[model samples]
Target: MSKVSASRAFRRRVSLCLLSSAASLGLSAPALAQEATALPDIDIDSTAGRDSAPATAERIDRSDLRARQTGSSDTAKLLQSVPGVSGYSAGGFSTLPAIRGLEAQRLGITVDGVTIASACPNDMNPPLSYTDPQTISSIGVITGVSPMSLGGDSIGGIIAVETAPPQFAQTGETLLTGEASAFYRSNGDGFGGALSLIVASDTLSLTYNGSYTQAENFEGGGPLGIVRSSEFAKTDHSLNLAAQTDIGLFELKGGYHFSPYEGFPNQYMDMTSNKSWFVNGHYAGAFDWGDLDVRGHYRKTDHEMNFLDDKGGTADGGMPMNTQVRQAGYDVKADILLGEAGTLRIGNEFQHQWLNDYWPPVAGSMMMGPNPYINVNGAKRDRLGTFIEWEKSWESGVTLIAGVRNDQVWMNTGDVAPYGTGMMQMADMMAAAAFNAADHRRHDSNWSGSALLRYDLSDMVTVELGYARKTRSPNIYERYTWGRGSMSSRMIGWFGDGNGYVGNLDLKPEKADTLSAALTLRDGGEEGWSFKVAPYHTRVTDYIDVVKLQDFTDMMGMPTGFVQLQFANQDAEIYGVDASGSVPLWSDERFGKGRLSAKASWLRGRNESDGAPLYHQMPLSGTVSLEHKLDGFETRIDLTWAADKNRVDPTRNEPRTAGYALLDAQIAYSWKNYRFTLAAENLFDKAYSAPLGGMSLGDYNATGVLRPVPGRGRSINAGFGVKF
Candidate 1:
């Protein structure tokens, strides 16, 4: 019982359990008559009017994510201003989001609903890098229609991050709350801080949160200066516990994360050390055969990479790699209430993962003449899912939703014989005889479905129509990378996209079929004006490319003339459109209030058996803003644009960016719980680049070519917060 007497005996048993639950709900001890409410109401509502009214996901809260977390802590750059999202940067904050055109493992990120995997095989730890945006309190994006209980691998969509729940009090009061924040930035001199705490009664509640960040190398904007190894540092923490009786609500959560470094000058290795841990348990209730939920989770990670002035150097040759992952999952659902206009849901889920990658072996360099190799050993993957959903609402105003899901995935690996001796035992005996002649194990049985429809056509307008069928599977370096020459598949080049990959032992899994439509117009309670427009189309089937294998070998197999790839299977097509709106160009009552916003996106992908194009696709973008507010202060100014991609991809020669426009600004202030913010970001300091950003790795810069990687210059950020 040390550690400050176990935190003063756990705060005196949480102040005697909030004074015995406020004396069994009878009340007394007025602490401002306890009032602190908000949080906890999670039934995974990926916004957009959840059960339809025309919206379909797009939510970001926590005060606009704390004014974009004061200049980047990269949660995909705070979701690149939403609308079809876009981001890629690879440094100064692990960017990489992309939506309409998909991205990384095809998207399906979650937190507060688990699902994480990214021990860098070039992903450099995604999954929103384990929640941070100062512990996100909400974020939901669902790009190209997804809904079948929101989980079924992916087809480019679904991102949800939540935190900040558990806050009870009332019923004879007893509450204590907290919040604190700080931030700074000026082109990478960066800084950070965050915290939160809570304690309640009405049957217990507790919470804690934390954050920290750091930065350095980042000066770009105008001629691409600094930008060397981008620089980063991070930390996070979480804890929660809750309970409420009368047959319902219960929770338990835990989290921890750390990053000792996170540079990535466009990747080729850099992220020396990342650690993670998680835990979960939840239950929500109102039984008697209606509304019930149950959840479970577990996670573990330990990643590491090198080559940033190598800690012990060994730039991939002397060997230095590491990765470890373990995951577990569970979920259950119920929501029946089929009478007054329908509602139904049913669920089941399970997940498991395990991975290990190693390289270990240094002692005298010259490419480990001593042993230690494993590059992905004992890998495994498993999944099981089920879903059923229904929703109704009519009286002519119409609304209909439907769902269906089924999954059963499995993958395996083990029997990788590579233990060191000379040239790492002859390169692990030719990569264990090319992984014992391929096919270690595989299985799949997927099926997904979705349907949505809404209509209202009046009272302010609405309309929506949707369709979906998505599926994905094929990770672990895209089917267990087992090397077959040329730096042995360049370790699957993890999306830094400069190319180099290999893995395809009878691969197959990606299946898609989408169709969407939306149109909305508001005025009722959203005040002034609003608008939306959507359009989508998709068609895929076995799309997982890398192609270009016209001969290229190395690692004791001859021809190192370069140009080789693998990971085949194609046949794709994509289409897109996303639009946003806002109006109200003036307001009074002491002069303050103005608005005018806009957003846009347009995407296209192809290769429908060889029409080409498709590989980091994403072109034609937009953003426009001009805002103002009064009393509590607020301001905004924006502009963002992109275009000029010139449809590339010719077997991965990709490249072709050009087109730019930036300019940003922000200002904010609040009085009551104290708040402040200021931002600037790329205001005229433009040197531009980023067509899916990804290139420019070691050497040549300062305009000496080796392009891509530019953007980020002209910074200025500030933040502050307080609450109690």
Candidate 2:
């Protein structure tokens, strides 16, 4: 009787014969969620510090985000099953995400708790590219030491993402529900669709969502077939409203996004246009010295880049760039309720941003002629944060948490121009007159802290430990990009490694620290078997990394294209180990139930003052899976592998990648409210290359040899969903 105890007593007799056939069809559970049009589970609770203030997060729910949303519309690739996460490909919806080796403004992403930045400067609309992975529903991620109520800039940790709340109707019943989904993929023919709607009564509720996607250009099994500026298009829309009262709950949300083109096979421009808008608000209830939360947000973007049509459009006068942004934020938190063992959280946050990044003026150019190339004008950043946390618990099973935070930020800018002067804008007019003669305002303060502990040693083991420090600043293109020519520092940078940057106004404010640990083991209920690990280490301190300044040589002078960096502040470190597990093999009753899972990470980074190696650092990755279920059908297979990046980043000459493995499969089905899926991604088409996919520069001007950025061939996905 041990095939995991006879498959846990045959899944507890098939969940008691489906609850006695739903109580002989009387269906209670809100009348079986009104016979499957479901919709009735929206309890925001003001983010509960993103599910209990981090001590190793990693969530990703909504039924595992329904088979990976038809395989990818990027959304940071849904954090690739989180475990030291990874992703850095650009375009096809701006990939970026990275965790163990920290990436991009050093983590701390959010959406729905707001905090979105990256209005282009080559980031191409980050913040998970404005949602839309079928309109999100969960995503958590706290990869180690992040508390202080998840605020105070960032240092590689937090990532929230949530959407789908606003559900109501029961006490007087009047709820309507809806859902629809679609997908198609086949290399890069890609396609998409999504829709959702909900309406309720019993204290109001409303919801709506929409999505659209497109793709083209994808073909690669080697020899660089296709892949040119990867191609993309997007759209999303949202709305939400909620209210409950009697001392609590309220919500309001709004969203819109557009992308009329994406491209960007590793930087050198291509986004063509992006538009965004957002709104947010929230409130939670319960008092008597307990809960209470509040939030507010606003966002706007208007970005644009250039060169598309497979990277050579606008003839020779095209290299535009434009940016405009505005952001606003607010947050407030409280939890209190320290009687039965503790909980006392507190929060305050604010953000403000404004930017302008001009570039217009070509009309028969000369390195972009006649006037207007201001790079970053009217910038501004602003932050204000506050935190306090505490958690506790005991009764011989320990638990603790601690926090502290402070932020201040404030930055400034407003002045710049070039394009109209002589000698190809003479080094952008001496770097915009030494950035308008220095002192363009600046200020910071920053302080952060965190701590965690756990214990639990019995009931299937557990342990955890943590520490944090965190801090960050400098971004507005990292101390305002005043472009030192070389084609405006190769049009700024987002590190897709086509090199050329410039910006460092005394740049400081990185800080980090971290240190983590975790362990777990299980074998008891919920179908037995489990395992976990986690290990972390950070260091940072001023870390922004980059140096060089100019070098072009060639024709035997030996420097060969792509150099010119800047942003400085060294010292770094990173370390990692993540692991995951699951097992339960075989349970049959006509062939059903089986499982096996695994995950891996193993990262490393450096440059603690030139030890080199740290630019997209991700090597030794992993994934493995096997599954099979029954009754409602399911199948899985996966493999994914990496290892062989050859520790690159010799000051951004970074490109190495070799070593690969891939195979994926999926099959799904459900009945009752409908669901269907079919997948296959790289199932043996084996071409490789994409260790962070940097350095393609859209095929390096027709193969002038900079390489890296292949990966993606063999797609075939299909999806379906329904509910009404």
Candidate 3:
């Protein structure tokens, strides 16, 4: 077939797939729906909540987003601009976002309204990693005291990401539009590009997006040259279809992702292969009584892990590990107008997950031969949640919002087995037996609620206070991993600390009670000066930490290196404060305008049960930037700094990192339908270690000792984009 014919055929197939998937999910078009209107430019990512609550969201503007895209490809890195948010570095593309000191499963992260779970043992394919930066429309973060409308399951807060929404052309008109962009960075010889296309009519629209990114090992400053096992390559594709009617809008999206190889510098293995496919559907409508929204999604993943060349792989593939995940969920919400001054929101959500993890045997290997090692076989976790929220505003400048939620979680797992019956496998055999003999099914009923109040003291000042009770159940890896052998335990940690971990089925759900307050002083307007400060404190019962299980000795009969640990429940406390401000420097018709912005945060976490410091807490950090804009050109300079990490977790043996600061600069110009960008990062080439980088297994393998991962050196970046 001709190229044009082939392209048409592919588009038809994708459209059919979207329709069929939506139909299979029992989605129906509304009878009274009206023609879809043009999507607004308002923030698209944040779920609805009281505007005056301490959970007020912060958004990354389009211009700032464009600048950040020129420097990196990781989607989670986009949240770094939000105060009290940090990142846990894993692979080149998988950086887990951390709010305050809580990370991983503690933060609710969603893409276009669908939540995707990590499928690998090392967490190399986190939810944000599935979306490419070039396609993102906006990113928003709610730091504390989140509302029940955002769903239940997280304690820290919510991080919402959204891609461009469906667009419809004017009445009786047709539209065809697209954009192409690419970027290159000097430090890692990294390069990537993205392509987006959309076809729309008055009532129907179709869109396609594709991206590819790859990078080599990046060099650290000074003596830290060519940090090994930090390379990766990835490709993603997505198709979306939308229909607008008199009463509502319906959308269906389908996507695929693949990564041939992605190195993990901090873990014991690298992701050799990863493939995932997903489908999602959404509906929004206006009714006589209220507004309604519905969403549903399903995803499946196949992942594999083993040693790569940088990690000294053996001829026999060095302990191959495999994992598979299947996840499905649905959410329904409705807004009912109580009166002219109040609104009531009610929602229901459900999620079901199935997982399997096993290691294949290697022929001619004494310890890993004869049978497969079943790590977490046929594990299942399901949750059903319901919530009701009310918001009311009084004429006296007082606003009150309150909500309550309940979740019923159920978990179960099938029997497991060891690698073989050899003497080397005795520990695994015993542990497996004990796990199988115990009750494999468990259930948890958790409740959460929050209340917020906002009062306007004057036109230039506002005060907001809130309190919340949140609960989270342990994940599959935290409760079902039954391996007790050293090597087996070493294969099951997501913290990237190079330490071994074993799971405990008797773990209890964590409940956190939190209090937060925010004070704002603003002049009210796009360019007006504004300053805000927020402080929050949380106390958690039955927090999942770890306890030492066993220790290993070196050649000299001395205790050294990583040790085995087991998950346990404990009490914990976390507190933090965030401050941010922005001011206009000058505005001129001929010379353009200038602005200055600053944000900073301080955090502390402690295990109240044992009086020990928590692991992976971010030190005092902040960023200051100056920006200038001309007719069609923009320039920006930023300084980012962090304080020394003196508080350490003795149990986990967390490392300490010295404080360091870095400078970055960028310039961009737009003409017609084209944009060009240039940027420089780490301008001084100063060597420093990232506090959240974890222990570098690559360094340990090379020097026979573990060390903190080094930060990337200075880099020059360039990019360009064209729209039609």
Candidate 4:
């Protein structure tokens, strides 16, 4: 069994033990049984006891979503339900969210506006998995259209995650709040928990959020039937402190995230641990000159990776690898009103990054004559940008948003010894190696622009239209990785001609055009009805994709022995529609309120270059949820259906996972002083696999050899939180 798989198996037993403890504490009671008493909605900015929208443009509170769905292993995965979004490689544990058919370098993820270094060279960190769900205050996504304050790092869309702030009451009394919860699954035996602390006084506040997760190897998809994986463990914690005064708000936050020895689906290497430290400072206030906000962030990441051959089972056969990245950023923005006709926002952003590594053959020898080798090709990159956005409002509750941004990126690729002293290159003792360690440096500048119009036709009906043009620069991996992506013992599994993979120094930026629309209805809790639907279409040009060259050689003609991947332009199209809403079932203040909410979504994409379905096209799916709350107690049930996916073309045999429905149940009790909850997912113990994947052909040869991908099975999770 792979180290990861063995570790997962052990965790399953632990999860079952925790679930037993929760059931005894009444954490599994149905919410429907507690309706004797309930609190009415409290107004944040309204004079009435009931809270109402402060303004048509103001953001609503989202703290209630925390711990809303524990035990549903896919709870975290649901974060990608935003318009124009898709998910790839649905491992039972960690999965990456793809936006507008663009991933990897085409996207950027940040915490409080600071970038987290991607630990795996093949992009396993993904842009979304960086933040813990429970710590999130609210997530805002701007598709096709972007706000200047983002610093121009986005291509298709921008997803911003804000940490929840401590809440303060009017009585001038301080409140201390905290909660803890855990759950287990029957199939994979997954267990996890989250703890939070919030302290708030009139003007001073502090908040902390932390979570740890562990799981056994999941049951195999039909084919792998339990492809045992590496032993996995992870822990993350975040702290935020803010102070408010009559003049403005001042705050600072710091966080630490770590994952020890996480396994990869199809790669040969395993990541020992990934650690990231982040700090952010901000100030925001409204003055006689409208409103102004400014912020700065600094982040440092320590990444370590290793490829162990296990010799299929033995230990000493593996190699060690280490890489570190340092990144820092600063941003500023101001919002000004123009005679109440509209608002203008202007901002500037600057960022820098540096990467250092010793791998392929750590503590290595060169392929030629026992020479020692050190890589100089991997080094530093810096990016800078300035932007502006304007918004106009009209009498009919109509708003127009438009923005433009420009950015420049500079890369410095230092030196690289022809053939690193790795196992593959050292085939011959008398081979000539290239010593031209050149500083291949280059800079790319791009412009992005977008516009959106929104109109509220009635109290319950709203419509929006949007369009945008954006460009993205090639990522470091696409521009610098030389020879095969020999990650921890596993070659990015990408073998072109297969001597070594070489990067193309001259790669172009990718461009995209998008058009989208949305319609929403707010059926005020009257009948417990609400809904939203969105549809979007995108056209891509100068699209950058991986082009592979098979077993090719270098200057010595001595079996260069590697595959080469170059970033080239390709054409593509992506379009999709998604709808979500809620409806109430049994409503009464006496028995407790009950409701059912459902979400349905679909997406379709294709390579304009060949009319084939684009990779990662999530099929039609829907989620049905029923919940009841009584006397500070809550109970709920959720059913999710995933459609069958038969359309696939790749290196590995992509199975068409059949349409399957998963069911779950949860119960929680809340008192003025605290709350506790427990949940059970995949209650049926349905044995099934969530099959998904994508692949590219390396024309470097004729017989297009397909590679393998990862598939996962049924899993469960549990989490809890509190307020006092």
Q: Please tell me which predicted candidate would have the highest TM-score against the true structure.
A: 3
Residue lDDT tens for model 1, 1-724: 4332343344334434433432332222233234876644646434342646236578788878886787777877788788888866675556768788877578887777677876667777788876678668888887757668777877777777878778888878888876667677888777766667788888889888877676767776797776666776767888889888888888988878877667676655677678988889988887665778788998898887766542223334434578888888888878788788687888888988898887676676544435566767868888899989888888788888788888999988876545453453564467677777776899889888888788887778888888888888888778887654445455467565555676776889889888888787889455588888898988888888767865555568785334557887788988988999898888897889888989988989998887888877878888898988999999899998898889978676667888888888989888766677888888889987778766666433223346666667898888776665
Clashes of 3: 8
How do all models score by TM-score?
A: 0.32, 0.33, 0.93, 0.80
Ranking by TM-score: 3, 4, 2, 1
Candidate 3 error regions (>4 Å) = 1-37, 40-45, 48-55, 555-557
RMSD of each: 25.8, 24.6, 6.7, 7.1
What pairs collide in candidate 2?
Answer: none
Top model number, lDDT: 3
Candidate 2 lDDT over 1-724, as tens digits, reads 4222343344334434433432333222223344223333332332333323344676776677867888888878778677888888888877888888888578888877777888878787888887877768877777888667767788887778887777777777878775666777899877776767777887888898877777777987755587788877777888888788788878888888877678888888887778888888888787888877788888888988888756676566577888999988888888788798688888787899998989899887766877778888878898999888888878788778788889999899888888877987888898888889888888989988888887877889888888888888879897888778777887788878777888898899999888898887888666878888988889888898888987855568887757988989998988888998888898888998898988999988988887888888889888898989999999999898988889888777887889888989999897776678899888878888888888777877666666778888788898776555
What lDDT score goes with residue 722 in model 4? 40
Model 1: per-residue Cα lDDT at residue 432? 75
Stronger candidate by lDDT (3 vs 4): 3
The pairs that clash in candidate 3 are 32-247, 33-245, 33-246, 33-247, 33-248, 34-245, 34-246, 34-247
| Number of backbone-clashing residue pairs for each candidate, in the order shown | 2, 0, 8, 41
**Which has the better lDDT: candidate 1, or candidate 4?**
1
lDDT of 3 by residue, 125-177 (tens): 89988887877877768887877777788787888787778888788977676
Give the TM-score comparing model 4 with the true structure, all chains together. 0.80
How much does candidate 2 score in TM-score? 0.33
